[model samples]
Target chain A: MKRLNKTLYSVSLLAMALALSACSHDDDDNEISEVAPPQPVTYTYQIKVTNLTSGQPASPIAVALHNADMPLWTIGESASDGLALLAESGDNSEFLANTALLATASAEQPTLPGESMEVSVSIEDNAASTLTVAAMLGNTNDAFTGFTAMDLSQLEVGETSTRVSVAYDAGTEENTESAMSVPGPAGGGEGPSEGREAHDFVSMHPGIVSAEGGLSSSVLTSDHRFDNPVLRISVMRME
Target chain B: MLRFNSKGFRKTVLATALFASAGLAHSADLEVTVQNLTQGIYFTPILISAHSNDASLFELGETASVELQAMAEGGDISGLATATEALSANNIANPAEGLLGPAMSTTASVTTDEGNDVLSIVAMMLPTNDGFIGLDNWAIPEAPGTYTIYLNAYDAGTEANDEIRGSGAPGEAGLPVPPPLEDVVGNNGVGVTATVANDSVHIHPGNIGDDDATGGVSDVDNTVQRWLNPVAKVTVVVSE
Candidate 1:
């Protein structure tokens, strides 16, 4: 009876090996028949921005994903023409078309003070490892805020990074604080003009010295004054 | 009771050196850069120093030292330089040579000696009574990388911020009118105040001036000279 049991077990093992070979043969046949390209992997990011200022309304927020070779704007350097247009006029059309961008998204309307906006951008089969966000302070001459060239590669799926940004003077336009040159609701004047300030390098903004603060020619009031950390931004990897 | 003496300090330093030579110390060569971020404010001759952990240039909520008072009031860094030298600090005085104008920058190189692991920077802001930019005792990182720091404006609290034109001497009561600022600053002004409310080092209240450049409550220009916090940016690059 024991000899019979051992023979039966050997037969069952041989049968299992034969069945595995048959399954492998079927998989090879299927691979040969199906010749379509592999599906592309999609990477999606969700960006939420909040205006922290008491009075300064932010322009349409511009978000872009790009490689680390370039930055939207640099400190102690001249502002690009695209950056100058957005900072002075609150327009993002030109900035969105930056040559280095792999994917871009922007808010359609102004982000009022104490308001938050979320934008999502997606790209397929490309490694855009850096993120940049920017918006103009509508009441000032050319003051803007947001971070640039933030590394997004380390963030895994469903992870988020939060950062607070300080105001920057674009230096493309002087801080005259006059209604004729400011294009915001407080000013209701013309957009960016033809000339740049003598000190035409990006730097930290000196803040608005409104008419109530002793700039008699300024159209802005004391309510429009703002300080550092005007914007809070968070970036999350959705997929 | 705890007693302190120079001999005891020297012995402690010698022991630290012996232990550091056994492979625990991190000495570095550093490149320091300071930039005036204000649109219209000028920085007086700056004093940059790297000293031991116990040494400091100034502390907030404390009375200003006489040497610090001279530098904050008159941009005279000689006294502070001498004081830090006694502490065996690596000092760089006035890398800009003269006043560092708005939107300008200067650089200095310092190779720190053993155990000098902290940095401090100080400079007077022109066209104000005793306003200064200060970086108080920041630790030098052990890693080899670049670091950035933002500095705020502080009032030395040794003199009143009388916005009118006056002497730059310690205990005086007016803003210094340098040759470059002579044309821009207004004259024949009454004065902002003759007294200081806070006698300790504190954040400076921004300047206030009227539209009347020829005659106003203050001599400084409100629109041009006013600045927010973080009036200066410092960049430090450390390498072995």
Candidate 2:
């Protein structure tokens, strides 16, 4: 049986950027611009994500490539409705629909435990860019794992930057672990709930209290529990 | 606080850039902030220190040092402080004065002497047997920039998590129920267990709490006392 121990309850986003800032030099493209404002060069990146959890399958990943100045999520801030939708129900439709997005791509299927998924996204005519990938932990109330707006300009062509991502609680909903409250496969797979949340500010996820432990009312079992560093992402610039 | 740096500051930036490339940091001036991120869990007095690379506050998969054990079991930082002082380390103890309640934060500033290049932190969690949040010996960067680190809850593995009323002394059974915890923690738990299975420092499994108030399997509230990983968030701003 899994020990399903107590982990920290601090929300954190660890984004490690091994950057090489070689921006697009427009010397050659200047000749083409004389005819038409320079045909936009496509900056494409292949994002590979590996689910590292024991049981939780990562929901369809929502990959957003943008150049925003701020991070997609913060430790002490409240979750946006887009994040709430992805974290609570394993849905990325709302998150992808977020404004200020430069380009977006998503995985068509769930990435199960110990599995990897590759999705590519490209943006045209952009000089600066960052990457954000989000997916639900498909077995909890609001656990999601992904990277936040990581600067993509640091990666030279054919270079890959990697980081091991940890799970985060949306903090929009309480982690009650009730069968009705959980929208994961362990519960009913009902998806994100449309309701008021408990904690307004985001933090690290305190772990699940399953019936296997002592929360007799908890809908999660021992397998539903997890630890940190749940997802590993490798981002490489292709074009 | 975002400090906008530019070309006019190229000298320091270049020096820092070189040091960063070599993955080394010399003496640094730092403004540090730590936040307790839980909704219901409280952190006792905190300890933050900047020391040499050879020293560390806690080591994973190792036996608990007496100093770490005392802090984990009873929220004591005196021993650790004295030990750190012996190393001529730059350390701050209890910036919050007392218990840092849920979601509360504290800040401290320190200037590191040459060769003191690592940062470490510790704070016991209330209503737990031997759980404490820890940041063990992270290398302080040479560059002047803002860095954020998340702390994980660690079990000192010195005592059994009986989940009942008990003493706070090291090697003693039970938790130290301060006035604040007394109001929230229930009484007369039959004791969860008498022996600890893992007697070495490890990640805490968490409190096995029940909803019972007067009589129950455990004294801690299942909803309130349990926590997940990353009990604390530490932000450090390095300056020239």
Candidate 3:
């Protein structure tokens, strides 16, 4: 079995247990019930994504919560301009600013391979509250991975769920595998260069074949070969 | 966890919703769907199987079995198929019938035989020395729902990823360029590495390509052929 990166899970569990246990000692039920329509409380969530890949660093994550039916990206569909930017350049600026979100958050730096970090957002957590998180696999062209519109309404005050995500091709750029095309350290070239050539439909990523394999023009090596489940994501309701 | 909260707004409400736990305790029918999640990599024939707890196709940190090496090195799973069949594993072989192109998908239904409580899957990634995507010893929840799992790239550690043209036969040094791949992959000038650093099954480090399509260090296109982890997505829907 794989050893789970569950420190964040444990902390959320402990906090929830304490919150629930606190009620057991109180006889203030009558007092609590006497209060009139209570004010809506703020709900906060913490999402920690660990880079499970051996060499791929994760672009800083872009996170959003919405009470509306908003999908950040869909398989078989072309990417929105904002999403395309995030996927190709590892820049979450435009994605985080989209108007559909009730709350949003982003990471300031890239999450290096074998490292884990947290990016969080808080919202009303009301009906229709759903989460969308996205991050680019920094070493590739237009490949991003994350989940969108995961229902958050049902999770209790203290519960955590971990999900593994596979890479997705934004279909915004052609996979060129050249030193001047990839924006990561492997390519060290331009990011999100103009002139798109793909059909522009999102789909499962087709992997890169570095110079070590067959693409003699590629700047990457065997060390850059990766598989699915690039990210191990844990979402916890913090408050 | 159900709680009765009287926080000033209640007539009595269950403010929390429960997400169904994706586990079970019995036999099931599964509709397994797998999608190639990369832009440049192709998947060879896929092998999906259900077996007992004692059986696993591969384990991390372990040496590659001869059968596994055959698939990783040459895109052949016949040997492993025979070995698993002898163990009473229920399998669906080559759901796509041939090479699954980039970003494509294949679906198949598998009914678990008695005592076959675990599921596993594997497929070779084309244009590589010994790279494959696989799932090993995943416990099928006795209960039924849609379960999604992602697969990572793995190296068979059997050959040096020289990135040059070579045979797919066991103990070969370079990748096998089939007719379809022959057009996409570049011709070699030099190889990448001469040795395998970790001579055991392990996570793939990823690919590195250059720009010289005709002649350079590799035949791969770094802009077109590179990728990240999570090369595939597997969705298993267990009958309710």
Candidate 4:
């Protein structure tokens, strides 16, 4: 049998005993009378994201709070049209507006190379237990970075959750670094097109193979390249 | 203990029981999730382990053990797993089911037994011959909280990091490109190097790739395949 060690068993048993004792003490207080609910408290969440990529300046971040049942994207699944649009074009307006959110906000501006930006969102009554922040790396074809569905339940009032997130390919387009496809200043504002020919299933980004790197046909140079965890995010809950 | 009278003996036993209960509170039930923090590399299946205070997966500046070499070069956890099992260690092998790619994450739940209180994780980073992401033995906290750790890349001392495509078998040179990585990685490129500079496990120097896909200083794409340290993230939630 797969069993816990004796010490763990004893420890778990003691914890369970204590919890049971607490529940027993509360059994008598199960009153049927209902009272008026208190006014909802608005909790402000401040988000600060730093662009960790050497060259890529991240797009303005799209921040959202949703219930546990919601996830921005999942591996092996096709990205939502909104996600595809954001990943491909570096415009997060659609993605932000599309999320059925408990709360939502966006960074005021893009985070430049080695620069940081801040954004804030507020929820009524601490209703959201999960938060997700996403932004595109403007230099890539369809690469985006952020955390999806991170649980914020344990963050006490004024407490912060800090994390570094890796980049992801939306799989909505082939990583063709042509001037007509990339939307950054290096590529001159080329936005999303009707051509969506990539794998179409979200996966770990297989980074940009630049012209100075190893891809023979790529138009991007080493200055347009980047590495992992392109963004650092810190979220503080202020009630 | 027997010198006490009946009443005193009963009191002594009760005191022992209370002491035992206090010891139990020190152990934690932890659920661990490891996320690959790279944008271009892949991690060979991981070996998550929990051992005593004295044990480690691989230490910096130390020569790589045969077990460590096997794990870092070929993504084979069996040798390391065997070594850990002999020490009565807690282990979770191949938690990602297969290669965990760049910017990908996998979760493994492990309830560390009381004696095996420190956690470690190791796996080879693909597209490189012997680079690996390693978590040196970290002590699990006694308090119930969620702790997150970011891991750095390491070079296994066993093989020359000739960033070319070849075999997944142990004792062989070059990297093993899985089916998923075939399209992303280049082919017909010259090898990176033929010699091992450092024979001890050390910090991995990031890759330097050239522009030519067919004949270059490295087969890896510099923009696509290079990475900085802290290439993996581990989150542990200790349930009270």
Compose the digit string of candidate 2's lDDT tens values, residues A1-239: 01112121111111212121122345444555444556678999999999888888899988998876857887668888989888988889988997889889999999999999999999887758888998999888888888888888657678899998877778777677777867777887565677656766666677677787777667788887788889999998998
Please write out the lDDT profile of model 1 over residues B1-240, one tens digit for every residue: 122254356457646765343222335699999999887789999999998878889999999999999988888999999999999998999999999988799999998876678899999998888989999989887667899999999999999887899988888778878898898889988998889989889999877766678887888877668788899999999986
- Please write out the lDDT profile of model 3 over residues A105-165, one tens digit for every residue: 9988888888988988887636568899899887777888899999987566567988988
Worst 10 residues of 3 chain B by lDDT: B1-10
What is the descending TM-score order? 1, 2, 4, 3
Residue-level lDDT tens digits of model 2 in B66-167: 999999999999999999989989998899999998767899999886557899999999889899999998989766789999888899999999988888
Residue A197, model 4, lDDT: 86
Model 2, docking class: acceptable
Candidate 1: TM-score, chain B only: 0.89
lDDT of each candidate versus the true structure: 0.86, 0.82, 0.80, 0.79
Clashing pairs in 4: none
lDDT of 4 by residue, B33-99 (tens): 8887665688988999988867888989999888898888888889999999898888999999999
Best by DockQ: 1
Candidate 2 chain B weakest ten by summed lDDT: B1-10
TM-score of 4: 0.72
Listed models, DockQ each: 0.28, 0.24, 0.27, 0.17
True contacts kept of 2: 0.45
Per-residue lDDT value at B200 in model 1: 87
**For residues A1-239, what per-residue lDDT tens digits would candidate 4 score against the true structure?**
11235666786689799989996777668664566588787877899999988888788899998888879897557888889998998788889887477778887788898999999888877655688899989888888999999888756667888998887888788776777788877776576877568757776676666776555656778787776778889999876
